[model samples]
Target chain A: MKKKKSSIADKIFVACNTLFMIAFVVITLYPVLNTLAISFNDGIDAVRGGIYLVPRKFTLENYQTVLGKQNMMTGAYITLLRTIIGTVFALVSNALLAFIVSRKRFLFKSQLSLFWVITMYVNGGMIPVFLLYRNLHLTGTFWVYVVPGAVSAFNMLVLRTYMQGLPDSLEESAQLDGAGYWTVFSKIISPLCKPVYATVALFVAVYQWNSWFDAMLYNRMKSEYTTLQYELMKLLSSVMQQSGSAANAAAAGATASAVTPVSVRAAATIATMLPIICLYPFLQRYFVAGLTIGGVKE
Target chain B: MARNTKTNAPAVKITWKEVKRQKFLLFWAAVFVIYGVIFYYLPLGGWIMAFQNYKPKDGFLHSKFVGFDKFIFLFQDDTFLKVLRNTLGMGILNLVSTFIMAIVFAILLNEVRSKIGKKAVQTISYLPHFLSWIIVTGILHDALSTSGIVNEVLMKLNIIDKEVNFFAHPGFFWPIVAFANCWKETGWNAIIYLAAITSIDPCLYEAASIDGAGRWAKIRYITLPGIKPTIMILLLMNVGNVLNAGFEVQYLLGNGLIKSVSDTIDIYVLTWGISQNDYSLGTAAGIFKSVVSIILIVIANYMAKRAGEERLF
Candidate 1:
């Protein structure tokens, strides 16, 4: 009788837990769905503001308005270029640093490791860094986004920990065959380090893709060097400021009468969000694996 | 020659032979070390600006020495003090809410018995985390707008008589920032806790059940204790970041009406340093933030050591 009572209690708990989980999922997804609905809704109608899961009067003009903007195309190209270049540069730099430090017999291994780790703790704050970039003539150029961020102390540590786990025999055999440090690193350690490479790549790519502060701070005048996220930021902020005014609807440059700040902002937001959403399914496993690998306390 | 350096001798002298033997590796390492100095350490030289009555036209070398003046001005300024308060208030609120929500979500998700259901829910939870703050704040503004779903629902449910302009109220600013953080990060932050919980041995649960402990009893005794170390470690890490209330959400969502409660130290630095071109004052404020962060980290590390918990340092 006691066992049956416990079983009934377990059933009740499971039912409640299931309901909670369902609610959690709905709450997590509802905002994105609502945005999609509003983007599809006719802009002026959307301002009347009852749209939730479905558009009141469906239209595709908002997307056309967003996609047709010349600045959006320029921004997209810049964002893509930076992500590709930044990830490759950061990976190579961090991996080389990790390889150098990971060597068991290197004379300055511990010293070099300590040097980089100290950087993780504290450094010059923003104004100084900005001034330094200006001194180096990095500001107002595309290289500002790519060069200064080439080395990450955290990613280097993550890569180094992975490299240190490999058997010593791997490198010993490579050295026995007249391969120098470069050959051994490229031919042996790197291929073995693919999993970690993927993790660090995803991390750098996401950072580069999402970053807009650099453009806003350094290249605000250099419209040619703007990023997609910066463009989206500009769109969102402009919309937010004049949200009540119908003047922005015409300013958005859409021939369609339905184009309003609400619709344009929604469409631009979805445009910026699409790549991340699409790639998430495939990349989620790597990031989860990456986080677990990174979560291990040093 | 590598053998000489590898050996743990009482006195090891530098020799050209050893340097030559490892020349290839040494060369590249030196290049990166120089890169580190130029990028990481060189900027630190710019901190001198804080001690000077700095003018960009005068450059670092020509600026007049005015020790502590910028810092004194910062403390005396009412705006700086208010920004400090907003930073701490929102930072603490975000820290507590996000941390607790992540733990709760992890525990609740772990309670689900169906494998597919758990995976699906976890996947969906992490979706918002991948989004940029720009997107997240845009969605938030729309939802909290006077005619948005929140007001619509509240009015429909008869919870309130009319719409509340959430962003306009000083009292609502902190909670809005905290809620935005929780919404964006709860699932992502829970990943670590869930990983910690899963690492707990299943035998603990089995043993507890055999002892006639109920579900809540098992969780209370076993699960919570199992993840305590992780909780402590994460809490310690977050304590060091208590002042970093983040600039993105505040800058994106904040308005002139809510500026008093909305500005953080970072935003203050940007406005004064970059926008206003008061480099010395900005650098002083920035230095203050960096110093406080280091001190907090050191204190948290020391306390963790005293408590016999694992520390970050």
Candidate 2:
């Protein structure tokens, strides 16, 4: 129905809301576009200012520096391996756990699930966990990424809830055919639950890709084990220190002869975000379903 | 999920055959159970260090017992108290501002006429939520640099003669953090409220319009009350994390100059406890955080239930 009163205040509110949303769109896009522009801009020209939305002078030197930086190949290799391997490991382990606890024939069902649910509510904080890993000799090793996070309790509950919603007749029929638990899970439950698996896999991949705190905590002393995020963290922190003092850059006049701090940081930001920008949009539809199912603790 | 269903239906005899049949699944369960106990439960035992003069050489058993001393010391210390204040301040700032903005955005978005325009704005807004904080804070650092775009714009508008180094000033830290958090999360958080608003009965609005009530009046009387449950549920859930103000942004953005305000409990643990090799003190601090959080969430959920609001537990 159309507005009956059509009062000036209602019209003004609509206009104001429209403007606010438009402003929001600009604020969201500006940083990404500005970062993109700076990444392509020549270091020297970028520092001279007025490089708003487009490159003043185009160059690829920043990426080259990033790719060629010390031990970057190791970081990239570790990051790639961790993302793929870690996501798969987590999904498989958590899915198996979920299936066990979800089975109608399975005894101790509530107790089995409750064992994991408690861990979700309480954690032993960082240092204890760190010390535990240290005692296990998991520190300064690549397995730290894989072994510790193999089965997430939250993802287990989500997958279990999703699986439990499926027809029991499907499993009963499979059992009548003499199909084993693993067989039914592999052939039927696994394929039928692709949506939830995909959702959890996406979450795990993103977490692995975004994790630098673990790297910093466990592998900071081990130069060979630096992940891509930790590498970027180091790069960003160093450049931020340098760029914090603007006068030093102007006095040094080092932008032309060397890559400027802003451009390098921009390049680093772009490098870190490229994969996310490429992957997240394709998987965006799964986000709401994932969040709701994951949050369905009750 | 239905444990009694099969047991009550079949009345199958408990025998070695049934045990053999389920052995494989239970064997599978054993693997994760062990992993959980090792990774999740083992460390919980380490919290005992909070009550000890823990030494790496002596280990857990031999560490001299200093029962409740560390906690008393923690409370007596001014630095711990200050970080607690900082954490609570940032936490409350984030809670109120983010909730208000999300609700506002949801209401306003529901008012949009053009479907395309509304979808485009929402899609753009979701970009920041998925991005890494390192990237976001990097963007902020560049934009807030002395010669950055923000300073350039402010100077052009003659807001100040000189540039403002936002990170250098402790006074602006909380606002910057709160606003940035709102910018990142508002769109994502609004999705639930939008879902709530969409489910609102159209008949109410139609009746309000038939009675000559305007858009604002309909929204005030119907749409808000319609979405009150969603708001209550989210607010209750968030109360569980009231102490978890934020770690990533403050840790990344914090420098020595702004340490007074930027040093959250997480940072305090890292700098004063872990960095100084005072593991016992750090464990004490961590235990204190854990205990207080558990208490807060329990009380919050209890109050929510008492008020007939949405309770997380």
Candidate 2, DockQ to 2 decimals? Answer: 0.53
**Candidate 2 residue-wise lDDT, A94-195, digit = tens:** 999989988877766767888997887788887899899998999999999988998887788889888888898988999899998988899999999999
Each model's DockQ score? 0.51, 0.53
Q: For all the candidates, what are their Cα RMSDs to the real structure?
A: 3.7, 2.8
Clashing pairs in 1: none
TM-score of chain B of 1: 0.94
Please give the distance, in angstroms, between residue B203's alpha carbon in candidate 1 and its true position after superposition. 0.8
lDDT of 2 at A17: 83
Judge candidate 1 at residue A67 and give its lDDT. 87
* Best candidate, DockQ: 2
Which candidate number would show the highest TM-score if scored against the true structure? 1
Q: TM-score of each candidate? A: 0.95, 0.94
Residues B120-239, candidate 1: write the lDDT tens digits: 899988888878888999889888877678878899899999888888899999999999999999888998889889999998887777788888887789889999988988888788
